[model samples]
Target: MKLKPVRFIFFCCFPLSVLIFLSAVTKKKPVKEALNEPGDGILLIKNTNGPTLGYSNKSGIKILSIENLYFKDLNKNGKLDKYEDWRLPVDERAKDLSSKLSTQQIAGLMLYSAHQAIPVLTGPFGGGTYNGQPFSAGEALASDVTDQQKDFLLKDNLRHVLLTSVQSPEIAARWNNNMQALVEGQGFGIPANNSSDPRHSTNGGVEYTAGAGGKI
Candidate 1:
């Protein structure tokens, strides 16, 4: 099957170290860092739009600034690890991360997060029950996750998550932090690589045109 190259860019565009500010306030989680900006924890680059990626302050990741580029201290060992170092190739970094991951963590990472509905509804398609009860039956926030979601992250050790629908940008960010802290605090501190299915509006968006020289 042919893969859509532009599919990943939906994440890539957001991954850019562009958000200068990141919200770092959580009740149970440690408030390691704080920013006045509206978004979540993300390091800033002077005179640039923002960062290429973001780090969860609750995860204890520190920003390593070398020259002009900024990298994440994912392992939180005070020094920059190989996987977090931008100088290394992605394969090498993946290998480094994989080597440190436990068997269960690997299995969890291998397992794909199925279609998950936030604040699970009551119907059959997007609705689900939390702890064998409807979402409204319990005092759960819109971002409050389901029992099964927790099982996959904690028991299955799955790190690769697939987000289906979200209430809002703020709610989504909060959910990301909550989930990250839950998993990042355990095992080898491997960060969750969250991805999403592309969302497109056919009537509103502009059309794509191929290059004349067969180039990207």
Candidate 2:
């Protein structure tokens, strides 16, 4: 009644294989938990397998947890929307968001704002008023958003902003954060897409027509 070599090896490995499979089936990834309290300004939720999420508590946005991963509830809805889920492809998320926008919101998204300057310059090119007075009147900080900027952001829902100048780098950063916070609290939590003119050298002597190929 001697067992063959192949049968003996199979018998020896059968129980061990079953045990390994059972252990793997029972194992699960541990969920990580983090609490974001009010007044935290901007909080970062670190993820081991996904994107790091940044949300401002002051913006009325909330953190949502799904299968141990955290996402931003940008629209403040309790349920997670496709755009708010980072796991999906960017094109899918964008399509989902586009389907949810209203006519006015879509129109606003298409609008490109005029040139804006941080602290609002006093000159004719990019000048603006703070609380109905010029920036040099000493009524507003250099980082403050001008009244005109606020009107375009809130009333017109304009998200595309063209920036021309800033008082300083620090002031520019502060103004940018302030503007983001303002818009993040608005509809759909859409942040402003700000652009600036080229800050480096320019050749004033060179000019070209729209249809021309080379510089004149």
Best by lDDT: 2
lDDT of each: 0.60, 0.74
Query: For residues 1-216, could you state the per-residue lDDT of candidate 1 as single tens digits?
Result: 335667776667675534422322222222233222335553333313333554455556556554434565666676777887767888998999888887877777778876665556455645666667778876677766678777888888887876656667667667777777666656556667666555454343221111111111
TM-score of 1: 0.55
Per-model root-mean-square deviation over C-alphas: 20.8, 9.1
Q: Candidate 2 — which pairs collide?
A: none
lDDT of model 1 at position 151: 83
What lDDT tens digits, residue by residue, belong to model 2 across residues 93-180?
9999999988888888899888777767565756789888887789889888888888899888899998766667778777877888
Worst 10 residues of 2 by lDDT: 207-216
lDDT of 1: 0.60
Query: Top model by TM-score, which number?
Result: 2
Where is model 2 more than 4 Å wrong at Cα?
1-40, 199-216
lDDT, residue 44, model 2: 71
